[model samples]
Target: MIDKIKRIVEPVVQDFNAELVGVTLKGAKRNYILIVFVDRIGGVTIEDCTKISRQLSKEQELDDLLGNNYRLEVSSPGMDRPLKTPQDFKRNVGRFLEIEFEDKAGLHKLK
Candidate 1:
């Protein structure tokens, strides 16, 4: 169900020239919390968050997708942009990154 929601929501964001970096669901007690992360060229503003949140809330409610009670948060990916997939690494090849790698020893840079 969550994956379906992500799929439906991601493209909608992409249509607005924003990249859907990730989606997270936290807090199990109250159904769940949905956080959608989008990235636009010049960074996101509070208005962007409000607009996406409003639209997503309506869609989730109309489809009854998030159960009866849940919090839906839509905003730009934070300073810690989620590294959700291998593609994230490839896409950010030249960008500065900080990560804890398992079975890794020293710091290395990708050219």
Candidate 2:
């Protein structure tokens, strides 16, 4: 479902020179919410979010893919969000970060 949505929205996002970081769908069957996280070399702004949201909202492909029951949100993955992918790491090449994780096997437990 997410992949299908990405296919529709990714190009629109890129049209504005932004990266489609991630997409998430949440809530019940008939009441779904779609959130699109976007970023770029200089970061994201409210205008960027608004433009993407408006453009995506106007897409017939989105309506065809998701129907009219879902809500679409476009925004940036802010500072508190964790960097979980190589691409994410690449974007923050020189920025300092606070890392947190759990050892799945408990082999190197910190506490």
Top candidate on TM-score is 2
Least lDDT summed over 10 consecutive residues: which range in candidate 2?
A: 102-111
lDDT of 1 by residue, 1-111 (tens): 668878878767766667787788887755788888876656667887777777776675425766768887888666666577775665566667776544467665442
Task: Give me the runs in candidate 2 sitting further than 4 Å from their true place.
Answer: 101-111
Please report, in order, the local distance difference test score of every candidate based on alpha carbons.
0.71, 0.86
Candidate 2 structure quality by residue, lDDT tens digits, 1-111 = 888988998999999999999899888666889999999866889999999999999999878777778899999998878778887887777776776565766544222
The true-versus-predicted C-alpha distance at residue 63 of model 2, in Å, is: 0.7
- In angstroms, the error of model 1 at 81 is 2.9
Report how far off residue 65 is in candidate 1 (Å). 2.1
